[model samples]
Target: MDIKLSNKNLGLTPSVTLSIDAKAKEMKAKGINVIGFGVGEPDFNTPDNIRLKAINAIENKNLGYTPASGLPELKEVICKKLKKDNNLDYEKENIIVSNGAKHSLYNVFQAICNPGDEVIIPTPYWVSYPELVKMADATPVYIECSEENSFKMDTEVLKESITKNTKAIILNSPSNPTGSVYTKNELEEIAEIAVENNILVVSDEIYEKLIYDNFEHVSIASLNDEIKDLTIVVNGMSKAYAMTGWRIGYTASNKSIAKVMSNIQSHSTSNPNTIAQYASIEGIQGSQQFIEEMRLSFDERRKYMVDRINNIEGLSCIVPKGAFYIMMNITEFIGKEIKGKLIMNSVDFSELLLEKANVAIVPGKAFGSDNFMRISYANSMENIKEGLTRIEAFLQEKTE
Candidate 1:
C-alpha cells in the first residue's frame, strides 16, 4: 500500500519562477544558446572580506552549532544594522536567523498563523508569499494592486480586506515582480491600519539595498511604537551582499514571536550555517564599497532594459524604481498568433520566447498578473541586449 501524503505538502504549487530557471539551465547544459532573463540573484560575487570571514570560521574550527535562533554576534550585527539603516531598534533576543529570507518568512507564518487565519497579500506579490501562507495553514486574501498605482497597496484596500479572522499582512518593498517601493506616507497609512485593527505586519525587505533612482526604502515598523510592536522585519545578506548561496536570512520582531520561532527552529533545522553566520557579521559590518558598485551597475541595467522594452512594438514596461526585474506588459499579444502558437496569456508568451527565440522569462500569472511577463536583467549587458534583440526579432517575424 502507498503511504498517503500530508495535506500541506500536497497543496503546494511548485514555484513557477524556479521551474523556469531550472529549465533554462537544463537547456544550456545541452549547449543551447538560451539567454536568460529569469535570474533573481545579483550577478556579483560575495565581497572578498565577507567570504574570508567564513573561511576563517572553518579554518579556526568555529563551525559548531551555536543557538537555534542564530549566532549572538550575527544577531547583534543585525540589530545594529536595523537601527542604523532601517531606523528600527531591536534587541538580540528579538531576532531569529533562518536558512534564508524565504525560510524566515515560512517560520514567521508558522508562528503567527493558525488554521484558518487570513493573510492579506497584495498582488502582483512575490511568488512565495501566498504559498508560504498556505504552508502555515492560513488563507491568502489577495488585493489586486493595479499597474496604474505603481502596484503598491494603499490603506483603503487594507481596510476592506481585513476581517475579524485577519491574522497578518505581508509587505514586500522594492517588490519582486513589479519593482515598486512604498513611500513613507503610504507605509505610515498601512501601519496605522494594522495598529487600529491589532493585526500583524511582516515586512520583507530582502531587496532593500537594490533600490534605484534614489528611492529610499522605509520599514513599516519604523513608523511608530504601535506598529513596531506588531511588525516583523525580515531581511538577509542574500541580495545586498550577493551572498545568496550562503543561505542566511533573519527576522526581527517582538521577543514573544521570536522566541516561539526559535523554539520551532530548534526542533526543526536547528541553526543556520555556522560559517555563513560568521560571514554575515562581516557582510553587515565590513564594507560599503562593493554594495555601491553593484547598486550602480544594476541601476544602469535597469535604465537600459526599461527603455528597450518600451520601444518594442506590442510590448511596454513601467520603469521599475527598485529591484532588478521588469514586468513587461504583453496584453497586446494575447489572442494573437506568433509562429503558429496562439499567445493566450503571459505563460504562452513566455513559452513562445523560449521555444522560438531561445530566451527565458517568467509569466506574470505566477505573480498573479496575467497580462505581463517578468524578466530579470541580472545577467551581463551583452546577454540582456542579445535577449531583448531576439525577442524583438521574434515579434517582428510574426507580426509583419
Candidate 2:
C-alpha cells in the first residue's frame, strides 16, 4: 500500500525535544540512570489552589464546551491582567484563548501569513517558530544574534531584513534556547523597525513572569498606539502558573486580527478546555504570591548554574538576566574525543554527555545556534548540582 501526505505534513519536522525525550526513555528503560534535561516543561506540579478550582469546576458539571474564542470570565480576567501587568489596554473582544501559547501562536501565524511571505525570526529562537511558519507555507528568514550581543538581534540587522514580501517578525523575550530578555531600549528600536516596515510583531511573552534581578519585561504593544495595532501579544498560564497540562493560552491584538484568530480557532481545536479556562481565570485574578516565590527560586538556581558552568575549564556561560535556562558555549570542547568518539558539534556533544555522564541537555542547534547547549535550571537544587557535576567531570576527563 502507498501512503500519501499533504504538503503541510511533509513541511513539518519532528519535534527535537520529543526525539530526545524518546531516546532518554529508551535508555532509562534499559536500566541506564539518565538525568533528563531535554524537557521544556517546569518540574513543579500545578498549584493546589488552581487544581482545586478545576476540580470544583468538574464537580459542578462545568465540563461543557466553551465559546469558540474562550470563556467570557476567563477572557475578562485576561484583559485585566494584561492592563495591570503590561499596561496594555484591550477589550474582551480583542482576546482569544487557545490550548496553549503554542496553539495561540500557531493560530496567529495561520491567520496572518500567506504563501511565500517572509517571517523574520531571530536565531536561537524557540524550536517551534520556524516549523510553524513553514507549516503556514511561509518562509522563515533567520536574523542571527551573536554571542557578543548577548544573543539579542541587532536593530540594524532587523532593519536590513525587511523586504516587500516580509509580513511579520516574532519577538520572544526571556527567549527559550537563550535566556535573553530584550531591554526596553532594544525593543523600542525593534518596534521602530516593525512600525516602519508595517510588519506585524508576534510577541511571545510566555516567560514574562519568569524574569530575575528586577529585569523589566516591556510589551512592544505598549510602546505606542501604532505599534500596539500591529503587535499580537501571546501569553498563557503554563510557565508562570505551572499549568502546562491545563492548556490555557490567549492573545491580545487588534480587534480584526483577534476575530481572524478566533475564526481560525473555531475550525481548528474549537475552544480551550472548559475546566482549564475556569482554572486560568482564577490563575489570572487570584493572589500572585505563588508567582513571586517561584521566580525567586528560579533566580537562585540561575545564579548557581551560571557560576558553576563558568568555573568549568572549557565551558563558558553568560549570566542570564531572566529565564531559567542557560545557553552555555561549549565550542572550546569541540573536536575532542570522549570514549573514542570525536565530539564534532553541539549534537555530538549532547549525545556524548547523555551516554557518558547520564545527564540529558538540549543541543543549541534545535534553537538555530550551533556552538552552545541549553541547560534548564527548572529542576530541584540537588538535580542541578548533580547534573552540573556530571557535566564538569565529563569535560575534565576530555580536556585533561
Candidate 3:
C-alpha cells in the first residue's frame, strides 16, 4: 500500500539553498575541500553572553512550557525593542513569538490568508516567501523587481499589482539574496499605498541589524498609525545575534491577527523552546556589542567580495548596502562554453563552479532570477578569498 502525502506539500519546492549547502557538506565530509557560499546564516558563534544566558536558564529556571505564544517577559522585551529600534509602539497583545522568523512568517500567512486570496511578493525574494504563501492556500503574485532598481518593488508597479483579491504584500529590507535595503522615502510611498489599498504589509526585518554604509532601517509599520496596524513586523535573534540554532523569532501585528496566529501556533507547535525564549530575553536586553562586531566583520567581507567579483571578467555585482550576500550577475557567461560545458543559466553556471572548482554558490533561479547567483559573505575573509579565487580560475579554465 502507498501512503498519500499532502497535495500542497507535494507541490512545494524544497529549499535550494539548504540542498546546496547539504551537498557541499557531504563533499567536505568525504574529504573534498568545498568552499561553500550557500545558506545565509552567520558563521560567527553565538555570542558568549547569549550562550551563558541559555546555560543559566537551563540550570536555574524551570524548563517547563511558557504561554502558547511566548513568555510574557519575552513579549515585554520585544515590545520595548520595537519601540526603541523601530519607533513602533506595540503592546504585548500584538506580538507572537514562533520558532524562527521563518516560522513567524508562516504563522502570519496562515492566520491572515483565505483560499483564493493573493499575496504580492517581489521577485528575487527570499527562497521561502512564495512557498509560505502557497502553503496558506493563497496565490502568490510576483512583481519582478529589476536589478537596476536594486531589486526593490517600485510604487508604480505595486499599484498595478494590487486588486480586490490581494490580501497582503511582503517587504524584506536588507533583503536576502540581493542585500537591497529600501530607503525611508521608498517605504513612505509604500505605506501610503498599503493604507489606500487596505493591504497588509508583512515586513521581514530579520537582517535589520546587519545593514552597512550607515543606511538606516525604516520599518513600514512605523510610518503611520494606519500602516502600523496593517503591518506585521517579522524579526528574530537568528541573524543579528548569530542564534540560528536557538530558533527564536517573532511578529508584531494587530492584536486580532496576533491572537489568530497564537491560536494556530498553540495547537501546532505549542510554546516555542522555553529555554530559548528565556535566553532570547537575555539576548535582547544584554549588551549589544556583539551585534556591532558581527556587522563590521560582515561589512569587510561584503566589500571584498563585491570588489573581487567586479574585477573578474565575465562577472559583475552591484554594491550591496546591507545584509551579507552578493548577487553576482552571471549573464555575461550565459550561452557560452566554460570548461567544455555550455553555461545557459544561473543553475548551469553554479553547478559548473561547484563540480569543477568546489565552490558552492546559490543559483539566482532559487531567488526567482536566472541571470545571477548569490554568494554569502557570512564566511571568514580567508574562505571568501579562497572561494573567489577558485571561481575566477574556474572561469578561465579550458578542457583539452
Question: Once model 3 is optimally superposed onto the true structure by TM-score, how far is the C-alpha of residue 207 displaced, in angstroms?
Answer: 0.3
Model 1 lDDT per residue over 1-400, tens place: 9999998879899889889889989999999999988869999999999989989999999978889899998999999999999888899999999999999998999999999899999989889999999998999999999889998896787799999999999899989988999999999889889999999999999998889887899988998999999999999989999999999999999999999999989998999999999999999999778988998998999999999999999899889988889889999999999899888988899888988899999999999999999999888999999999999999999956
For candidate 1, the 10 contiguous residues with the lowest summed lDDT are 149-158
Span of 10 residues, lowest total lDDT, candidate 3 = 391-400
Model 2 TM: 0.98
Those runs of model 1 whose alpha carbons end farther than 4 Å from true positions after fitting are: none
* Off by more than 4 A, model 2: none
The most accurate candidate by lDDT is: 3
Q: Tell me the tens digit of each residue's lDDT in model 2 across 1-400.
A: 8889796878687777778878989999999888877877777788888888999999999999989999998888998899999999999999999999999999999999999899999988889999989988899999999988989999988888989999999999978878889999999998998888899999999999988778889999999999999999999999999888889889999999999999999998898999999998878888888888898998888999888988988889887877678898989878878778888889999888888899889888888987899888988999899888998888778646
User: Sorted by TM-score, highest first, which candidate order results?
Assistant: 1, 3, 2
Model 1 CA lDDT for position 172: 92
List model 3 lDDT by residue over 204-280, tens digit each: 99999989888989999988899999999999989999999999999999999999999999999999999899889
Give residue 184's lDDT in candidate 2 (0 to 100).
Answer: 92
Each candidate: what lDDT? 0.92, 0.89, 0.93
